[model samples]
Target: MSRTHATPVNAVDARLPASGRLADRAAFEAFRAAATRRWDDLWSVERMVVSVGVDSSSLAKGAVEVLAACRRELTGSDAVVREVSGNGALWMEPWVEIKRPGQPPIVYANIDPSEVPALLTGSLEERALGVRDGDAFGGIPALDDHPFFRHQERIVLRNVGVIEPESIEDAIARGAYSAYFQVLFEMSAEEAIAEVTASGLRGRGGAGFPAGIKWESGRKAKARPKFVICNSHEGEPNVYKDRRIHEGDPHRILEGILIACVVCGAERGYNYIGGEYPLAIQRFRKAVADAERLGLIGQDVLGSGKSVAFRVRTGGGAYICGEGSALMFSIMGVRGQPRTKPPRSVEEGIWKRPTIANNTETLANIPDIITRGGAWFAGIGTEGSKGTKLMTVQGPVKTMGLVEVPMGISLRTLVEDVWGGMRDGSTFKGIQTGGISAGPLRDDHLDIPVDFDSMTELGGMLGSGGFVVFDQTVCVVDFARYMTAFNRYESCSKCVPCRLGNPALVEVIDRIRLGRGSLADLALLERTSKHIIELSLCGLGQVAPMPLLGMMKMYAEEFRAHIEEGVCPTGTCPISVAPSALVAAD
Candidate 1:
């Protein structure tokens, strides 16, 4: 796909004067009023609007061309064409919306530039376009009314597709920094921590650690030059929730960071994002600069007598860097490897001082937690896992995209209701939750709640809310081999068990796949898996063997058939005829 130079329509121009930047309360309100008045005008209404987000920009460049073409053709029609954040449904990219003054917005997905002229003139056939829906407000079947969105309880993703990502005015109008201001002026640092603790908010970064406890430790730790880190290095395959937030709602994240800094009494902050997410990095950089210009993140923030410095650091894209200690090491200008936990990051972190590290989603939830109060936030999800979770569903599902569902939601409901079941009427087999690190769960396990404890009880962990579905055509053995190989390759080689055992595990799985395995090989595989799990230093080494072990336990009959019959039951693996012929000859 071709890259387009699409800037946010609400982005503050660099050439503008200081007063025009709208840094203060009066200036921001003035800007909001003017923007709203312009939109509310009836005589000169902007007839058509085309908004493209990171997902669409990555998936369909043709939509950008379509937007440009529409702008040129409708120059006389007073139409507006601009880039906006995606609605989290990545499958419907290059999503276009047409709005008249009084009529509901006309939504079209996967739009191409070639269809621009016809669409503007109302001459295009709706069936030919990709996922068309109209009359959003008048009850004419809008995108939000769809099951994929209707069932979701959006908290972090509330402002994603609704506002321009770079528009601070729009974000503030929608209550972005209100929480930070509340925390700064109304509540004391201890009060803030107590509120979060009372709300039962836990970290969304797979560990399920309580956020309040971490903050309290940072606040009380006897260290100077404290720091806060936002972990956006989402290296898991097919997981893009953090990237989406960074791209679509950069200000929300910044606000959350500011709140954390205030509550933890930290003056320095770092946003450690993955190097692969160029767009997210760009947006985040702009958001920080914009916030600084507005006196929200620098010296004497909002005139509240507090100062904080923030920087953005790009990781080397190692999966292990997602670990807290490993992320800190990368920021300290060293190799991205996990460190042993004793002092922990809260007590001793970057520069041997107190630090608080949180994932992008975890930090993003802070603003809401402060604004709504901890108890209000806690009342939403299950008894243990409070609040909502942003999940990325891929693989054989009919509708593969990002979804924000409440905690304790069953996997069966998510797959059948939200995703509309598997594609091509395929039978459901299993799903790999929490990315490749977590083990796969069979169809029978679908009814189990997807909270942290429930998933852990079933030998799976919600390792950042990645749910990849598989169909009947998928072979569990082959899938296990693929996941194991990924972990082996991405291992940081910091520990002996992971560095050596991962490749050995891959070799054993390959031997079984080739119909050359025995019961003795299975015993060796189990022993090696246990050794890797117990002896490894960090999470990467410890959880590396989960997929392999899960498949061995869940699909024992399939493995037995591959060994005794020398054939793959699902026909996904190629079997050698020589093994069977040799056995017959014997």
Candidate 2:
């Protein structure tokens, strides 16, 4: 563990103030008491800390070459390297951790960069993977008893992977704008909308709805120029937990969208996001320009004359701009689709006036329901679904990453006891918790209960969570013709049953997976999936035929074995197709 060189100014970001602006709430509680004394002197105990995670799936599995091999091997040693945030243990990509000085934090996994000098000489205790608060070091086990983070449950990923996200003073030294400094000095906006309607909060971007009745109807929509966007436009398809909570805690959803722009008086706000999330739009535009150069959000903010203002628009690659009046008409640049609701973006939005979107995990659970209230965040989950959700699992789960739990946890305990099942001898065959209009549970609907009215009572939903998984090597009629060619190429076809019933349910699930024939083309793929779910306009042509009509009503014998005994039962579809070297080159 060679590191005797003590001098690397602002080691990796946390010096904090470059300009000015925290002129109120007693100068932001004396700048969060000097950013909690340099975040407890960067984790004291004679210093050694380190961390190194850097997300986006650990920067495609290397974490920037383990943060340039921990600054080229703990540059001068007393070690306190930085760049944190990927604690979802993404199947252990790069990762790291350390702690030392008297030991405690440990971690290590999938290392490399020539194994960081044999992981600083402890010679990589078999790539650790444990040891957070104390004990179980080399024998590796405690990271809350591992098993991919034993039943997750973190509140908005509590300072996601432990702070340093482009440091807004390490997120106000880990307390980040104390609930926007008690709603900018001792509450009101109707007690933060009655503590987020006593915290039974919803709309985790899958339409659970009730976020304090959509901010008290955008604070009684009398409208003096209200707005609050943030629907991040995350073009779904196995979503990435709102791109890892916008690269692990973008100022906790920008202090829950600046407490929903002070309970909806909303001077302004926006964060449309998706341009395929280039690192959550380059780490939320350096956290809204270091929270607007410390005023803690533009003008009179912290000094509390009460203004508001936020920016970071980005998105243009539309997935119907992740809906919500097409993400407030793609932040007003327009043509992002979804409209006709008489007057609903909290009473006419964007250029018409009042609005309030809130998605990235529902404004990341509104800064802990305004710093620990609302019955302590509605005493955690279940009961019309409160608190945590995040989810994102992905395929053959033996820890595919991201999870937060607590909302009537079941899906057989988030895939067999918190992500530790289905990767051995793989053959479970079902799950798709939500995304691509979900609904495909199997294995007796894996014990149900994942909230949002028990996944909308099994017609299936709980969407934005995006679990996925599947097996027996997949082929439910070519997975309903690749989810109807991805909802007919992201249908913003304005309307007309998704502009012609999702290309006629992808040409009747591609002539019933190829072997042609048909009971009237399976009754015209069930009445063109009930006329595109009864005349679709929005909600993507009404759940784009709920995953090809829930895989023909639960794999109707794998769509009558490729249209009446032609054969393809999990042989991954083939039936009467050309291939003996393409029929001897035809």
Candidate 3:
């Protein structure tokens, strides 16, 4: 289905103004009103309507005007423009086409949501009258011109919301290889690290460690045959930011890794992906092939005197794989488990070589930093954090999708304003930030800015952009237990503390929920939790107790009621069905 060529504009991107593509609300409203008036002029012949994304057989609201403008500019007369409502949601509906005096109107095909209520449900007096089978809706008409889309966006997320994942050329046009080209042609080993350092970018896959620091460590290490690893192992339960980046912008990650290889003088780079992300793996593999075909991944890239090869390595669906050292072990065909520090992955990584392991998002940021000057890239986010952060807004929100926002924005704004607040118009209860490792925050804490240090102040670190919101109805005790169970399952059994600690902790919580718990059970949980946090081998085990600990501090009554009366105050636990545990009448 050929569309009448309209470009898209992301309403939130700050770069839009620089490119002169930002649309004023009033001008856009005028365009919409004019389009509606044109529809009123020809309400009889056309019968159907639709809209879609810019690339996937969809039209911008301005596409209709562009079409009209094109017709008038070329043919110089008014085309009969009839708007018609289609049968389904706007994404699936067909575009309602206008007909020239005697010509028949034709509706375009394959709209995602076919329902077009705006044009269909009105009397002429009420201003809702639409043409028969031609009424359409969901049109944002100000962004149809192609020049609005010409900026080169680098954050390993260049392809998202811009092109269909299946399209290959979209990646090519987005400046995906400029960094790789620089690494191969313009930069030497130390020079590449210097450029990255100049960018002031940190690892976006959480930890917020400086990317240049990691690269510098690996570059300066004495170990021969250094390694560069792309950590695609997204093990967080609700986190999907990495998976989307790997799937949609594979070349960006590839380019980043290639740059790392050049800077560290390593001959090989490995992409370690999580087992659960099947679609991500498939898309990345195809992207690898596509990059190789274009001389971006393999030997002698773009006629430059540098060559490095890369491959995909899969992790066995373990949350621990997101940890840097654990991923290195998994890449070496061992169980995905964390190792002790003193010799970090930078000094001694896979096969005991000088390895630089970075998360998928961090690597994705490299190309853009190098291609665009570091100062230019650094100016986007807040002062400390120098780039836009990608976050997955899910659970009890009006719009549940991937979004990238600047660092200083408050969490409340992200939840209440950006996501349109709670789901189903329900009251906002709490939010679980940073997956299982993150602490839960009630409504009062939502105002915390979502940067690394700010979130940590509220007992929640910016773990990995997984912002799972809950409404007032969700039970805190049940939520803790559910998360505790996940921690138990994902614990790498290398250490006795994490292995024995998580399961034992799960059982204690289970007993409390079952009405069989004693007051002593709470004491045991308190002591055992402290021991686990202090004695666990790696960050996973240390952080696993966070949810339970947070609940004990934030909602202690919920826990106490479960243990003291066997009745879940929130009515969440199945064992709360019994009545004897309830306090007898005094």
Candidate 4:
């Protein structure tokens, strides 16, 4: 399942922007003019910035509108397209030089329709724009159509949705290789670790382990030819953040992966993206080629004389592959089953050499941290979970998409305020957050902060930020059964707990849904869940029982009603007779 194909040059310039040497102002103008001259179907060439709301959930539609407008306007005309950040929009027409990250895209300062001579005379129009502050709205005169600006403190995900896929120049334009360059040229391996440690970026791949701790351990490990693995195989359903980043911003991700290789003294790295994400595979492969052509990846990058190589490896549609150890095994051509810890991935991983495995999101942040100081990055989010998180908020929500928000915000704020409240007027039943690994949350838990520690206490951990909400009509029993069946289907048969326990749990839920369960059955199910959670070797088994346990805890009456009254309270059980059906006919 290799999607490694050499990308044709100019395909990028045709599709997105002119990369490489054309990144400069003069080259940008020359390339833009040349491309525009070749294509005669040009329409208006005015610089337009389409703002997608600051929320991650706004990305899909926001991206669609921005692209649709860009296509509608620039389809025939080869215009200079650049992205600006002042307005949360993907600026298509080159209003400002968006060659750098952290800096806002140029805004038209002191614009006067009075100066229509440039437009009337057909002369090049020049406008100066300043970096507008957040509070600029209150003080500055707000234009009727000025784009809404929203920006979060970024370190890990600086280039995610901002950059074009596979464009090394785009990544560089977003401060891509600067982190590795800094590490290679300025900072020692220890200094790099200290910077990340100070930044307080916990692993975004469900495991909230501190990134610096992982690096320190890997650095201290006594293994030569160490390895680093970029875990992009996002097995969690509903979580599209990683896939989107991989498809939309592969270069920055690779930059982070390469940084890990340098910091941990690793010789090789693998980007383990799942088979489900075909677009991601294509984009990442193209990005790799683009990076190589620009001397970003492979053999002595950036005149450091340090050789590092990488390959994009696709998994066989296994959720277990997301587990760090299993990811390493999959890269080594073995079944994607996780091994035991103690001699963790740090001490012995891919090919049994001390290895460091990080999620795509985690790797994505490295460049920004390197470009901007760690302290600058650390200022966002809570003290514990410093920096932002990419959360995929789907199901029972008006705005169902990905969002990057500062940690420590209440779940209530995210669900109600940010997501535009649940789908409709239907009262929020609960949330199935963190995917199958996480438990459910009731209304009472809304105040729970969205950081790693707070979520765990409320029966849900931040597992890849796949938060699926269910409205009032959702059946907790059916929901639990659905999750149990999912675990049963995906469970690797490497262990008896997950292999047998998952199916057995599913059967228990099915029996209860069929009105064949007793109170004792619930007790037995609880015990079974305990066994699975405690004895399972990998993350799958440990978290398979989460839905069942959480549902039982949150809505025990729902299950009891199914067993006692032979009625699914939420009217979801297939076997349950409707009130209308039970009513006597004349």
Candidate 5:
């Protein structure tokens, strides 16, 4: 779309000190006191409350206006109305929770403004409290008990949808910065890095590089004024994990950044978010301001004598800006393009200084690793890939939204059990993982574990954890052409292979689809694809041929049918036909 950069506002003007709101320790004490009180006292008029967390507020059409209408209509009512952040369950929003002290929360999904009046008046019969048959328990099923939620291990998404995005108090109440505090006061920088290395935490962006090794590079580098950049430019199509995390749990990200800064000896930090994500930009900026005001990010942070300056910079909506070197260049007000490595971003980056650049989800895992210790975190997921992964499931699935599952879960379980199988009675054909860069896998590969090494072994990379399902009706050849077109558009023109090769691939696929291809064209396509893969400069160019390569290998019969038979096996492509007059003459 467009590119814009913003400097963070000074901490003083951001907001009032967080002391005015409830701290985590104080919140726990208050909860304890409220628990022992009588039911009548607990459910008093002052305690009646309702909260809404409209997921995908910005992208979900009319959701923001609907939320505003709900708030306005609830004005002057005995119940307290509060707006919260969504829990990554975009399909079930606008998710609402109505609670009275000592009673279970009454949850509702996909609520419209027209239903608010009746809901506030206690006309419960007119509204469905849950999305599915077993979703309602007593009033509404506990959020954790839902099948979609029960299978997840929410670390980065811990406070999401449960707390207000802009409220530091609400965040702390849910243990937002507890890990940061423990890391700051109890653990040494070396100790923190050791813990992370032991946890086997890898970068969640795409490349599964170890987080500890990256931090250690910055630590050992002989440089001053080291920097850490939070790579929040989530530009991948059909992936919304980073945006949802920033919108729902901004504080957790901030806390993670602070922890990274401390461990890596970074005196300055920048959260580089994409310009397309206005809501994410706004929320993260506000969160940085709030943290600064509370001494969580500025000089003399939390009275620990540690100092760091934090800022938020927006990036142009280029796909390449997601790369570390390209992102650093964007921050420096240059063209957002990738640079050759040897002196990587960790060694000499951001004005030729040592920098620890990490993705949003990677940094979000830091606080938990610090507090729980490395071995505890390592206990989850596969031996090579530890911790949970946040994935976006779309396409033909019955349920489509953001989901977090521990690493090593089979794709079959995720598609069938988590997503509830395909929609419209469709049969599964294949799945595309790691966004557009990775290859596709057929139904037989569904049983494979979704870890970094395992996915690599299956000729795919879990690049950013985007799982899109395809049904029996999909033509693999057409899908490859579409993906190649996308790669052509986003190639950055940095190298000849991606810039020139992708367009060439698209043309060949189109020729084959339109009944103009020969046996020679198939050989040419394969040769050209291999050359592009071998000669590309960046990951974008390197992975450009994956979709086409994958399709040719997995569905060679489909390609042969199009070339030899001149008909689309899946009936998705149209064939040339004789004119009506010509048919009559015949």
Candidate 6:
């Protein structure tokens, strides 16, 4: 945003650092002090801030009109109706939060224009979700105690509902660049990488590789102009965590990027977001520009003499582009297809230089790791998988929303407790972890701790942390066929296994779904799925058949019902025993 459009609420005042480059901690402290005062003023009885959740999810549910309604209603009042980002409450959107002078901020959900009056007048009791700090608005529970949000750790989403997504001041007031500032003045690159490594943050983008190990490789390489890329172009079905972070907590992601740049000595950084996320892209673009103005990201960042240039590259919404090498391919202006890696991305990535690619959620953890020492983060979660994970629990879950919980929590806890179980009295069937290409975990597997090794031990990749919960209304065979079809449609066509094997698998499942399948076809599916996993060139192909295998292995009775009885056990698939032509040919 330009100076003309800047207001006292969003703009930086003269109390900040005199130069774009900060010389010492004292300068930053001055800025923080001013920001704190301004921030506190917004919540005071004198001013009374009415922050509206104006994120992408809320906007879809008519949040703009709600915001407009708040502005119209509080036109002459001392209350300030400001726009804040979403807290990932998808089912409870159009949130209206009012911070009364003596009381804590009360959050009311499903707030429409019609409820804006009741909200300001404190008559909106039924729409109340909870309170951020509980003064009891009609006895709604505290968010810290809410069933859906109680277990969430909230490191990545710390500023989500607290700050304006577009306001750098709001971001700063809530401790955005403090970690980066600390890193610039307090720690060496080696020490920085050690902090992350000690924190045990694995890559949140599919392969759960240790992030510190990748940074070490990137730093040790005898290469010039190292690069850091944030893969926000998540194309997995029913996964919206990346877009949610990008749109709601963009500065957090950017701060993580800057920290990575400092550690890896990268001169350039790229946030490869998908084009489908227009709001995220727009907000991120503004974030980059604003940071450059504030000297947060430039040749000499905050006078630390460390230079970093960051840019945003939007993809054309290809699922394959979510893969690391395929993302590198897209960024290079080439066909977004995966290539075999010997010289991994850390050794040779975009433009064939040493690069470190971390996904949106992975990088978002960096700033926090730096702020509160590495050991602090390592203390959370299970022994192997440390720290928290930002997860999107979708499908028919009762309280479907984005949650940040420590790793090693069972899917049973996530599905039953955090997300409030199945919606509409639906019986639990299974779950699809990661993308459509991941696990369709059964009821037995619900007790499995949701860590990388545990999920992988069950033959599923915990990629992207997007869990698609299903109920008894879904047929395992039908779900496998649909997921296989998705893989078929999204195959990059570079390799035969993904391109050809997906269609072949789709045909077999289709036949079974339509009641034309023989018992022999199940064996054929098992063989082909294994074949795809073994000979596939990339992660997409490698995991494409997981759904088929998961259903076949875990829910064999369902497949048996489809083939042997010529019927769907759940009565979800449309069975037609008509003779069909072979889909064996190209």
Segments of candidate 6 deviating more than 4 angstroms: 1-27, 134-138, 576-586
Displacement of residue 26 (Cα, Å) in model 2 is 6.9
Model 1 agreement with the true structure over 1-586: per-residue lDDT tens digits:
1112243222223222343333444554455455454334411343345455534344455655765777777654434455667777766676676655555556666767787777777665462222233334543466666778878888999888766787675576677788887887789998899888988888888888999999998888877889999999999886889989988889899988888988999988889999988888988898888777777777766557788899999988788899888899998899988988888988899988899998889999999888889999999889999999998888887777888999999988899888878888788888887787778788888899878788877777777899888888878878888888888888899899998998898888777878888878888889999999999999777888988888787788888888888888887665643343322000
Candidate 5: where are CA atoms >4 Å away? 1-46, 57-61, 125-136, 574-586
Q: Deviation in angstroms for 116 in model 5?
A: 1.3
The global Cα lDDT (0 to 1) of model 2 is 0.78
List ranges where model 1 is wrong by over 4 Å. Answer: 1-48, 54-61, 125-139, 574-586
Q: Write the per-residue lDDT of candidate 4 for residues 1-586, one digit (tens) a residue.
A: 1112122123234444444532223443444444444232111222222221112223322533443343344343323343322122222222222111232333332222333234223232244233333222313322222322132333444554455454455555555566776777778999888889888988998878899999899888887879889898888766777877776567778888888988888888889989987767887898888766655566766566677888889999888888888888888999988888878888889888899999888888887777776897799888788888887676767644456778887788777766657655777889988877878998889998898888787678787888888888888988888888878888878999989997888888777877788889899899999999999998767888987898898898888899888888878776575433422111
TM-scores for candidates 1 onward, in order? 0.90, 0.41, 0.75, 0.79, 0.89, 0.94
What lDDT would candidate 5 get against the real structure?
A: 0.77
lDDT of 2 by residue, 345-371 (tens): 778888888888888788877887888
Q: Give the CA lDDT, 0 to 100, for residue 350 in model 1.
A: 92
lDDT of each: 0.78, 0.78, 0.64, 0.68, 0.77, 0.82
Candidate 5, residues 1-586: lDDT per residue as tens digits? 0011121111111222224223344443453233223222322434445668855553374556656766677554444556677777766777667765545567677777777767766685445454221245555555666657778888888878766788675676566777777766777889999999999999999998999999998888888889999999888876889989989999888888888888888899889998888888888888887776656776666567788899899988798899888899999999988888878887899999999999899999888898888998899999889999998887878767788889999888888878778888788888888888788888888899988888776677788998788888888878888888888888888888888998899888878877788989889998999889999888778888887887788789999998999988887654433222111000
Off by over 4 Å in 4: 1-157, 577-586
Q: Lowest-scoring 10 consecutive residues by lDDT in candidate 1? A: 1-10
Identify the candidate with maximal lDDT. 6
| Candidate order (TM-score) | 6, 1, 5, 4, 3, 2
lDDT tens digits, residue span 1-586, model 3: 1122121111111111121111333332333344334334333323222222221112333333433333333332222222222211122223333233332332333322222222222211132212222323333121111111112122555455333343334454445565766666666667777777877788877788888888887888887878899888878888777777765566778778888888887878999988876767876888777666555556655556567788898877678888888888788888877889968877888899888888888888888778776787778777777777777766877645566676777887777666656666677778888877868888898887777678776677787788788876677877887888888888888898888998888888877777788889888987888888999989888888988887777787877887776677767675656544533111
